[model samples]
Target: MSNKLFCEGRWTEAIAQYQKLLEIQLGDADIYYNLSYCYRQLNLLDEYFQALQQAIKLYPQEGKLHFSLIIDLRRNGRIQEAILNAENAAKCLPNDYTFKILKYLTVPSIYENQEEINFYRQRFIQGLQNLIQQTYLKTKEEQQSALAGIGRLTNFYLSYQAQNDIDLQRQYAKLVHEIMAANYPQWVVSLSMPKLQPNQKIRIGYASHYLHSYSGTLWLTGWLRYCDRQNFEIYCYYTGNEPDPVTQQFQNYSDIFHHIPYNLSAVCEQIIADKLHILVFPEIGMDAQTMQMAGLRLAPLQCVAWGHPVTTGLPTIDYFLSSELMEAENAQEHYSEKLIRLPNIGVSYPKPYIPPVVKTRSDFGLEDDAVIYLCCQAPSKYLPQYDFIFAEIACRLPEAKFVFLRGTLLEPRLKRAFAAVGLNSEDYCVLLNIPERLDYLMINLLSDVYLDTFTWSGGNTTLEAIACNLPIVTCPGEFMRGRHSDSFLKMLGVTDTIAENETEYIEIAVKLGLDLAWRRTIAERMSQNHDRLFDDKACVEGLESFYKEVCSKHFSA
Candidate 1:
């Protein structure tokens, strides 16, 4: 009966039936496993985990259960437990390549110091070497079979290590290509130039799971909106994300839209059938499925934008779409693909819509007189090496409280870092989750200044803060990924807050915290030049010209 309900998509009914079966102690491993799947479908993660534990106790040798547990544990910010679980799984299933790969790939979601970052990075490299050796030893059929599961985890956190990762990226990409090509030789085969009839439009493809209500979506929306629809046929292939209004908007924009499943072969064949003249992935390296897709040579010209802002390292990827303002002169050295620097910020962004209702600091349990230093980013972006910058700013001003999201993995790491420096982070930190979209904007509006993360700068968050007229203090890094806000500020003609180094970053942050007039002056300047930042006509023109030129050149060659 439970199995019937499970197959019929009745998760809640399935859960009740499974619990009833277990009430009289008549359950087996299959019952417990089924219950766990039902609980997971309903988002009862704790319940799902307990059911998995029960199943594991009944059948200790179940490699699939071990794999699921490790994945969920890592997803829920239980990294320490996940690491232990992976190690245990590997010990039990010694011959299982999945467990071995998971064991080596598991790293902390948040780090303690630079030494910790270096340690895991080196371990990752060693693990890659081991994986390469294992792959080389496998038969082509074995390698092809391994391809389905190997992409479950990517080197996602490696990009946040504040270092150039071109070499590591290339190594991983090559391994992926070898596996993929063996499994599906048709996709890896190179295609000739697209010979489109003059009357027919150039079919351009855009694929990503984050095409709905994500920061990645926000970054690439303007490019779609400003596309020359008359000459270009946009094909949007969305994978796995639930359809929201943003998803619908993309569907509306595309000449052909495929809200496809995550099935690898099906997606690959559909894209090949479309015969895209050019394929533009707004971001890569963030999504496992997208990374796998980017490994195949499906389009005549393949390009990736800086949605994730790191080198893909895949030879299958031909170009990295970036910005002239964001990239340094030597930026070409950081990417495996040929870097195509687009004009302005590389995106003609649609400015964020300001919500009407504003909430006060007191309403949100924040002090009215305090200088709210907004550092709202994904917790991983705040590296421990830079925690002292906050401590220095707090010492300069007693009423300074840095704002971050609640229920983050970095909370304890941040608290310990401040405690090491003889300061209690709780006193100077406002860790609250503002869940509503309007409330999110309200928090940004009530803040005094925006503190941009040094190495992994904010793209949509900075743009939203600028919508609130917030003064941003940013220090650009050596790579293009760390220089987003620096470019935005420069485009808006606000230069004082663009710091050159760590010391200058602190100095600028302190000045913003200390003087109300200075903050207002900066905000006023941003407000005056706000129009220059949006509806970037030249960026669209440049992008379109690049498309035409590339198509012509590839055809001639």
Candidate 2:
């Protein structure tokens, strides 16, 4: 009966039926699991936890249930417990590689025991090497059969590690290509087409899942809006079918806009049917389907911009379009794609919409006189080592309160991280989930200084901070992913807050927090220099020139 309700998509009715079944006979573990699913779908986390716990208790040997609980624990910021659960699952199913991969992926998030983490890291590397060896030694057919799961695990490993090392990043990316070559060896597609007229518009297509008010959407919207429409015919292929005002605006600018509701193959077919001379992905690696499609040869010239800001590691990707200012001196050595640097901050950015500051410091429980330093990047962007930087800043500015946007599931981990560095929870605060964009902007406006994350720096958030005229203090790291705000600040002509190293990062943040006059000077400069960074027309022209060069080279070949 509960199954009937569940199949009919009646989650509340299914919960009721499950409750009735539990009242009559409570020993059935499957019933409890079903109830947990219903509660999870309904967003009743407490009830979901209770039901899942009961299910696990009733069926301790069920690996699938254990895995589900492990995911739940990890999602709720219980990383250590999640690792332990994965250990138990691995013990229960020794042959399964999933649990081992889970344990490996959770290692970076664990900051308490460095020695234990080192041990697990070594074990994971050794296990991965062994898997790669075994998989490579297999026949083509066997490798294809095993590549699906192995490919996914390798991608996860690369995603986490890309924030850390470039050499290891290259290795993991090569492993992905190896898997793809084994599975889909015929990636290149041959095209027989007519030559373009003397002044035909270059057909270009931009594809992604984020076509709304998101990181990629915001970064590429200006390009779509201000591109040389006469010389470049643009097509937008959005996988996310949901349409908002931004989506409608993109449609208004694009010559052809497609909201792809079909599968990956169908989406690929649509692109091929368009016969685009060039295809661009604003970002890759955030979605599995996008990554898979990216691994295929889709167009004559394929390039990726700093949307996700990492090496794609696919041979089909021809160019890594990066900013001239943000990348390090040795940036090209890190990317698998051929590096192409664009002047200024690369793509044209949408003009920031500064909503009215509706809330006050007092309304948010912040003291009127205290210096507030805001670090609103998502939690996963934070590396465990950067806790010391925050601690040092808090220590230097005793009256300063560090603020972070909440709901990133890093509250407990952050508390532990700060405690390890001798800073108490009282030294910082996490602002609760702000649902409205205006409220988020208000928080940025209310804050004194913006602190960027160390490795995976904030992209859209950095622009929003600039929009609010908030002075950002950034410690640019070794990779392009960590340099978005660095580039933005440079483009804004405010390099005083861009720190050179970790020590300088702490000193700069502390100086900005304690020194009122200097901080205000930087803020005023940022406000005055917004035009340098917000010049969408110039950026679009640069992009148009690059597209024309790529098209000319392709057709000439």
Best by lDDT: 1
lDDT per model vs. reference: 0.84, 0.74
Give the Å error, residue 257, model 1: 1.6
Name the runs in model 2 displaced over 4 angstroms: 1-17, 25-34, 37-70, 79-124, 131-171, 174-194, 407-423
lDDT digits (tens) for residues 1-557 of candidate 2: 99899888899999998888878876467777778889998879888877877777678766567767777776665767777887777676555545655655444433333354456566656655655554441476555544443433334323433344445445554665565566656655544332588877889899987788787667788888777777889999988767788888778889999888536667888888898888899887776567766777777778888887888777778898888887888888888888888888887787687977778988778888888888787655765666667667766777877777752555565577668767785656555667677777888999999988886787889988998889888877778888889999888888999888889888888888878899999989888888888845776777788888877766777
Model 1 CA RMSD to the hidden true structure, in angstroms: 3.1
Q: Where is the poorest 10-residue window by lDDT in model 1?
A: 136-145
Q: TM-score of predicted model 1? A: 0.91
Q: What's the TM-score of each model vs. the native?
A: 0.91, 0.84
Candidate 1: tens digits of C-alpha lDDT, residues 394-476: 87778899998643666777687678778898889888888788888999899998999989898999998998899999989
Query: Which candidate comes out best when scored by TM-score?
Result: 1
Q: Lowest summed-lDDT stretch of 10 residues in model 2?
A: 153-162
